[model samples]
Target: MSQTNNRDGSNKRSRILSSDVYRQRENQSSTNVAQTQSGLIIDNETALSSEIIKEQLNSVDDIITQAIIEVPTKHLLYVKELGDNLFVSLSTKII
Candidate 1:
């Protein structure tokens, strides 16, 4: 790959967080949420706690995952198995 493409690829790779890495950083307060790529740290007061969600979907692999996005809150809840094409399209658009 060209130098620019290689740099871009590295940037993308750096943004990815393993579940272990995420769990490590997930303890910080929501108000202290960093403005950089880390991992999703959903507020405990949200409708679904991350722990509960994980337990409910136990054993599934990457069906619903979280990642840091390039935004203020930095977190993105990525649902990989949304079966409805139109819903996915609209959701992506809204996002």
Candidate 2:
């Protein structure tokens, strides 16, 4: 999905539909398959770019990305924790 630049240059966040995100994922999957067939390696840096993450999580209102202090190239993507119990559950599921 191509995003249009605002003429006013304001930092306005637009709401992305879940369907759009799903379509984008499908397109990427096909491209990745082609790349893999051609012997290309998808590295961490390419796979985890901020723009890609933002596009993937566009429908999520509270998506966040925080760089690992020791590893600038690595980041943790998550939503804000609403509560301790919720965090525990999410972490458990993720792990």
Maximum-TM-score candidate: 1
- lDDT (C-alpha) at residue 91 in model 2: 45
Off by over 4 Å in 1: 18-20, 27-95
Which portions of model 2 show Cα errors greater than 4 Å? 1-31, 34-46, 60-95
Reference-based lDDT, each prediction: 0.57, 0.51
**Clash counts for the predictions, in order:** 0, 0
Q: Which lDDT tens digits does candidate 2 get at residues 49-95? A: 78777887776756666644543232322232333346565546453
Candidate 1 — worst ten consecutive residues by lDDT sum? 73-82
Compute each candidate's TM-score over C-alphas: 0.24, 0.17
RMSD of each: 23.1, 22.8
lDDT tens digits by residue: candidate 1, 1-95: 59999999887776664645765655453554443355544444537778888897896666657755465432332323333344645545463
